[model samples]
Target: MATASAVAAPPGEPVAAPAPVPELDLDRYLGTWYQLAAVPQHFNLACARDTRATYALDPQGNISVYNRCTTWANTVNDITGTATINDRETGAQLHVSFPGVPTQDRLDGPTNYIVTALGPDYSWALVTDPSRISGFVLSREPALDAQQWNRIRAAIETAGQNTCSYLTSPTTGGRGDIAPLCST
Candidate 1:
C-alpha cells in the first residue's frame, strides 16, 4: 500500500489522489474495530498484537480516536487522537492526528484517511491514507472465518493494497484484551 509520493511530482505531474469510496454513515461506523492486519508504520512498529481502535462522537460532532495494542513482553500501548470530516459530501475523507502535532489543519492539507472499503453491516473496514504509506484491515469480530478472510483480502486489493505485504495482527491468541485470531 504505497501511493505516489505527495512531493515527488516531477515538475508538472499532478499528485495522485486517494482511492474513492461510496457514502459512509459515520454514526454506524462509530464503534470498536479490531485490527486484523496492516502495512507497518514507524510509529506502530512496536505494536505486536491485539491492535484495535475505538471511535466515539464528541459533543462537538468530531470523532474521538483511541487506538490500542500490545507490544513485546505483553506491554500495552494506547494513544488518543481526533478526526474531522474533510469532505462532507462523501463523508469518507478525513484527517486525523494526536494532540500537539503541527499541521492539524484538515483542509489546505492532505486528507490522509480514506474509507476505501467497508462491510455491508459494518463488520469490517479497509483504511488507507492518501499517501498510501499506511493501510489497515479492521473487523468487528476478533476472529475471521475463511470466507470473511477471503472478503478481507479482496477488500484490501480493491483499496490498492497488497495482501501479501500485510503483516497479520494477532487478536485472539496473543496476550491482550483480545487473543490473537490470526497467526503472524
Candidate 2:
C-alpha cells in the first residue's frame, strides 16, 4: 500500500475546499487521460506502461469507463467500468464498478470516488474519495511539460497529499529515458 504524511488541518474543522462543483460538464471531461501518477492500489498491479483511461456518457445516466495499460509481458490489458454520480448536489462525487460483475445489486455499495480538483479546461484532474482511500493524477497526454507538472504537484500538496508516496508507472523501453513515470 502507498503511504504519505497526513497534511495538517485544524482539529475538528473541515478543510475548506478550493472551489464548488458547478454542473459536471461530462462532455468536457470526456476523452483519454494518461495516468501521470497515482497512489498505488491493487487493481492496477499488472500495468507496466502507457496507462490511460477513456470516458464517455452512457445513455443510462452513467459514465462509461475504459482503462487500458501495457503489461510486463508486453501485452495490453483493458477493463471496463461504469460510474454514477454519488451526490447529485455536487455531481463531483461518484461510484465506479467494474464490468457490471456483481450485477446491479451492489452498485451503490463501497465503490467510492470523488473529483478533488479539475483544471479549467479539463486537461488535468486530481481525484480522491471521501475516505481518502484512493487518489490519482490524470492528464490529457502521456507526459506533461515542466510547467504543467509543477502546477499539478502544487495542487496535490494543497490537497494534503504526500507526494513521496506516488507510485509512477514504468514507461515502455522505446525511449532510452527512464524518466519517473510520474512525479509530484
Candidate 3:
C-alpha cells in the first residue's frame, strides 16, 4: 500500500511565482522509477514507503505503467495504468490515471507533468503538474544517497517549490509520519 500526503495547492496562491518547466529528453524518460517523495494522495495511501513504478510502451502506442507498493502490514499492492502523449510535438506533457474503476474517465486534462529537470542517465526525475497541484521526486531506488538527494532538492528549489510544505515519508512505524522535509 502506498500512502500520500494532503494535496498541495498550486504555486503562487499565497505568494511566490509559479515553478518553471524544464526541457525534457523523452527518449531517456521511459523506464522504471521509485517514488521517493510525492505530494500524498488518497489513492496511494496504502503504500508503505518503498513504492515503485515501471513504464513501457504499449501496442496502442501509449506508455504502459505498473505501480507497486508495500503496506505497513507487509502486503503488496499493485496497479496498472496507461499514459498517452498529450502533444506529439512537444512530448513534454502527459496524462495518467489508474485502470481500476474503469468507468471513471482517465485524467486526460492537460497536466503540468513537465520534466523540469532530469539526470543525465535518467537516474533521477523531477515531475510536477502545471498547476503545481502535484509534484514528485523519483529515483531508481527506494533510498537515494545523500548527494543525489541534495541534487534533487536543489533542482526542486530551482524550480521554485515551497520546500516548507514538502513532507518526508517515514521508513518505519506509525500510520505514516508526515513532517516537513525542509524548513522555510
List lDDT for all candidates, in order.
Answer: 0.75, 0.68, 0.65
Q: Write the per-residue lDDT of candidate 1 for residues 88-168, one digit (tens) a residue.
A: 898998888777556653323558789988878889888888766688888888866777777777776666556666777
Clashes of 2: 0
C-alpha lDDT of residue 47 in model 3: 77
Q: How many steric clashes between backbone atoms does each model show?
A: 8, 0, 12
Top TM-score prediction, candidate number: 1
Task: Write model 3 residue lDDT over 1-184, tens digit each, in one string.
Answer: 1112222346665533234334455557778787767777676688766677788888887788788888868998888887777756557677776655453347465443566667767788777766565667777655667787677777766656655445655443321455655631
Collision count of model 3: 12
lDDT over C-alpha atoms for residue 101 of model 1: 53
Candidate 2, poorest ten consecutive residues by summed lDDT: 172-181
What's the distance in Å from true for residue 64, model 2?
Answer: 0.8
Candidate 3 TM-score to native? 0.74
Error of 2 at 161 (Å): 1.2
Per-model TM-score, in order, reads 0.81, 0.78, 0.74
Q: Quote the lDDT for 80 in model 2.
A: 85
Regions more than 4 Å wrong, model 3: 1-23, 101-104, 170-179
